[model samples]
Target chain A: MGYEEAFPPADMKWAGNAAKRFASPFVDVPHDRIDVDAIILSHAAVASGYTIRDFYEKPELGIHCVAYASAMYDLLPVTHWFFSLPWVTELGIRLEYKDTLPPIPAAGQEHVLKDPSDVDKIHVPDKNELDKGWTLPMFKRLYTYVQKNLGHTLVPISYGFDLVGAAAELCGVENFIMWTFTEEEAAKKLVRKYTETAVNGAEGLADTFGSAMLIVGSVLGNNDIFSDEAVKMYSADNMKYYVNQCFRKGAGPQVFYHLCGNHETDYKVFKDTLMWSPFTVIHAGYKARDPFPSALLKSEFQDRATCMGSVDTKLMIAPNPKAVYDQAKKQLLEGRDSKRGYILGTSCETPPYTIPGNIYALTRAARDFGTYGTW
Target chain B: MEVIMSDAVKELIGKRGLKVADVEEVVKNGKAIQKKGTNHYIASKMIGDVTAYAEYDLESGILKKKANVTSAYSHRIKLIKVDKLDEVSDYVMGSTPVHNATLQMEYMTVVRSGPGLATADGSVLMVEEYLATKTLAVAEGLFEKKRA
Candidate 1:
């Protein structure tokens, strides 16, 4: 059940060295000791009845590995800003205007779209304009490094883009809701502008990376914060537009869509919008009260795409290690029989405070019970 | 000088044994200072040897409280009065208290205005800075009561 038992020390050492060489500074563990890929696979194999080789052979798994690397290297600067504005304390990033404001300022003070009438002010930055700073060069260096060193084992992907979520960032959440109600036309225009920007950015990255799997990290389009009617009316169309734009003329690479938060009533919207698209993998978070059963995935999305995730993030922080193992084991056991290949992962981001022992426990459970014929 | 008195102001003035006419004489030529909230206004003046600080509710013209201090506590005591005005402004600008007589319940409701803790029901809990800024706006007469 231990990490070494699941992954040979040699494989762990190799992955650790790869992580250290490319991931430095960002990943806290020592260069020769960082083995996130082995950790992911050693645990994943236990749940999916697949060997490490079997996992890597699948392009989807490669995409996930690239997504993790992109995150570790901070390839997506936009996503980092999303985290920094709200949870800077948790991430230990200092705020620039801390002195002028009180100890903590309001969340939306940095919002750009203060007025609905100013939607026209939003502009999609050209590639050169976006590259004027370190983000572009750093991303290029990391992407090139990942593609060169880990390309054979894992695909190099951008953690991906989020149109609606980025729009929420530019337009304060309150103003976003206000505009949706009071100025529907302006809101639609804003969404269109951002969606086009997102598509352009994705295409640009895809061209640079030469075929990378992209992840939309937080399809805020599926968030319950907006009313069901509003989501149906506004968000649904925007998402459909994004999908169409990304796939049109082969503008971007294949996509893996990730959505968080309570979406009990809204999953149908995603299903309906994306049902026909061949360029997506849907990873949804779990609703603790109504866990996403494998049968539901089979019945609802079997023909369209593979489904991943729904392991409760709460288990990652549970007091007892056994709780984490038990939860991971239960999820794997259910997913072992799934016709659509299930990739076991936390329903949401593993919280910053989740302990290493709990993470190891997840892999331990997978290794112990994830044999091909065990189910 | 225009003097307005709330119930609390009358009590403080009566307890201190200061005449309203004397406080008004100083306030008439005082410098006006504002705080965070719309209703909070303070007027400070030095008359001969005594410095008088008067806190006023801008909306209703009610003098919430007044303090008179000799050179020693003049600055410190005036700050104290302004702080009191901030508290009153928070209560006034915050959501109105909801009371259910049938259930014998009473509680004030506040929207989650900034980044902080949130309740299970998704109500954002108030952060200290947000509370300070919001209440100060009310005290400074910068807050306008929104028409419901």
Candidate 2:
């Protein structure tokens, strides 16, 4: 069957509901065609909201695209085959799958960089090389296929490289931590190399797709893993460079940085780095200690950059849909007074098994409490 | 589908010097031997050459479970081991002491006159002391009892 036949667009009933409630741009459903379960779940989620006859009936939801094709290659079985290929294996990078957990990048028990000097071994594949590689090809195939099918209905979000995360994957968390302290020079060099490559790659994707927003996933830059000082010195510094490069390359003005952990201490670094940048959005992931992102929006970023997310993933799993609605209400109320825009979403990716009821409650709460000018 | 460990359980395993992978392997391969609570289940099986246990709380979405059994077993040795010499030294030192020497079986080192004691070995004295603590924890309802 054709891809479109296998995974049909959102149900007309649900689409219509979503369209009535939400503005032109609505919440972008992640991976609505991965399987039968996804299709059913996506329909349920859409039905729960005000929908439009077509996916592109409104442009307000901005550009809705699934970039997971590139970011989460480890989840696919094809990745294992790609890793086993002689050509890919020669690069000294292998995909490590443990039971059912997401695949990790490793060089045997150690990372590609055993020591500081091994920074030279760190290879940031150029665009041509990446296009020829196995994983990227698979990602491109999925992206292109989705674009070809859904492009008319939805804006396609292309993939952008995550430099901080890519560095951690290459060096391994342990070695990366050690290098930060003991081998600062080599660590910095490696980070710089990765940062430059990521900037160029992201710019290229932006140029190709003409996407409205370029999302840079930098979960490793959170304060949970690094001290506030280190976050500024490393993550913040590189982010500044990234934003500058994107603008320089005319990769659209809006840049959304996805940092998916606790960043109470390092949040300021983000503010300082991107507050002045053009049309920035901070996709703050959920933190158990602080379940609200309104403080971030209302603060120094009040008039600057949009803030997205703060809903705890745990709440989505709560048996009571009211719990999800309550949290969503709280998030909306907190951001009500902010001059900056706020987008309601889960702190991170919605778990594949998230109940349809809870997903419905989220959009329901957004419609109930997220009304513009409704305090 | 495999159960994902909660952050609390992950932190517990890290503190106990066990890899999350070890506990995950047991959970994936082990048979369900018992139920602990409404959402929790206990699985037991032999993984590779070692017997393994996993406690999973399934209510929290597809992921999110408490692996108490893995955390318990991973720290079994450290939890059971006690240092009688350090206890003796603490008693001898009382509130004040210039210096004191005591043997720590766990660390395989002699504790020589210090405010705090450090041991590198896994051996300890009076296994009952450890058992008492476990009993206390169980009595305190830290872990759920097996369903009847």
Candidate 3:
């Protein structure tokens, strides 16, 4: 209902468990169970029986719902929506909120940048604009409350470190892709602008948030957009500059890579390139539309980083509980024995409208198969 | 969910320079409409940039089943992943016509220690054969002692 009801300041047991659950893969904190860090968005409402409109209008409800639903379903982690919206908001993207859904990009919000030279189209957000929404002022307050009162870190960047995708979003996709070859220097300047904003903005608030988790949701870095050659020789090469800079600059305490689309060609390029934080968890999304199996991730990544296996959002949205349970079981069995540790997660955000039974199915699968040493 | 990888299947993956992750992608993304009759599903995927389709049914990088051959690669020399870096390093050192053994080690040190994915530990690699070939010779000319 409000920040006071969001997370209890006295709940050290809950706080410690939640902290260890997320920190387990990277640290020896003794949390060995397989669980979900679903990045549950408005979908937090889907699990808690609240309307999506309520989550956005009163994000504390979303926070409460996350805790409520996570406990209800025995899910081990929770995420907030504030980490994402400001990226679009800073781009002058208008959002139209609805009664039953999170805000969507308003119609007629044209791509803001006309060319690579239109570098002035975006700017680094100041602390005030960090919550630039009719209702978003609450996030700044809630996050501050969470950290100071609850002793927890709140920010995990979703779309940060994605220099290529962020730049493309500003200009149109085709224009940005063409300029990578035709106007290379100008394009790099444009990408560097967004990269600096993402990195520096976090750095500026380092004392407040304690640590920024630089998560790279390189959505546009998917194989469909560029050849393995061009992506390797170009896109990934360009973005790695910022990635190295993120590490070299000490932008965060950890880095999470959510390669959000088909990466069959792109992963090879990334596998041998790019820096990873010790707490790195790479959750590569579906290929074409199928979830990237966890077994492949283990073979490919070894113990270099924790590999998270995902259940498709599509399957979760369906009413078929058995399918969700089966898929979750498959992913849990495959990844539960990973040498570097494994997490069962949704491919992206668990869709806000996903049916309740399907959401419960993930918890059921975890109990049946994800308990440590069973595999 | 069940796609078997025999030794021959693994070799097909290795020779092409791909990883198990790539095959998982191909299989999962595919309709897997069991061929009208065959056990092998014709796994197809859309290629990057270029309007084309590429098939990627690579084996998982782990060599659980023994193989007569080892190394894994991608075009222009990127390692998808390798079972034994020593085996691949030996081939590059003893064979590759680019340079002599001494020069090769010097070059590889520079490569592994440099930047990007191929860290000194050598779990996964980013090999640059063509570029390194030219660079190695340049280094040799600049540093190697002239025979009296």
- For candidate 3, the TM-score is 0.64
Ranking by TM-score: 3, 2, 1
The alpha-carbon deviation from the true structure for residue A358 of candidate 3, after best TM-score superposition, in angstroms, is 1.6
Q: What DockQ, on C-alphas, does every prediction get? A: 0.01, 0.01, 0.01
Pitting candidate 1 against candidate 3, the one with the higher DockQ is 3
Model 1 error, position A244 (Å): 2.8
Provide the global lDDT of candidate 2 against the true structure.
0.46
Residues A5-92 of candidate 1: C-alpha lDDT, one tens digit per residue: 3322223344434434332212111122111211132223323334434333333332333334333322211111112122222112
Candidate 3 lDDT over A278-298, as tens digits, reads 346788787666888888877
Superposed by TM-score, candidate 1 places the C-alpha of residue A185 at a distance from the truth, in angstroms, of 2.2
Candidate 1 lDDT (Cα, 0 to 1):
0.43
For model 2, what is the error of residue A360's alpha carbon versus the real structure, in angstroms, after optimal superposition?
A: 1.6
DockQ of 3: 0.01
Considering summed lDDT, which 10 consecutive residues are worst modelled in model 3 chain B? B97-106
**What's the lDDT for residue B29 in model 2?**
69
Tens-place lDDT per residue, model 2, A1-375, is 553443335344443333232221111121211110011211221332423222122112111212121111111111101111112222355764433223445334556667777888667666566556544444345445546754422332323435565665566767787788998888777777677665555444544554323456556767777887787767777776665555455443445676667777677666545412223456666453666476655574554455665678776656888988788778777764444456666776554345657766766676677655455
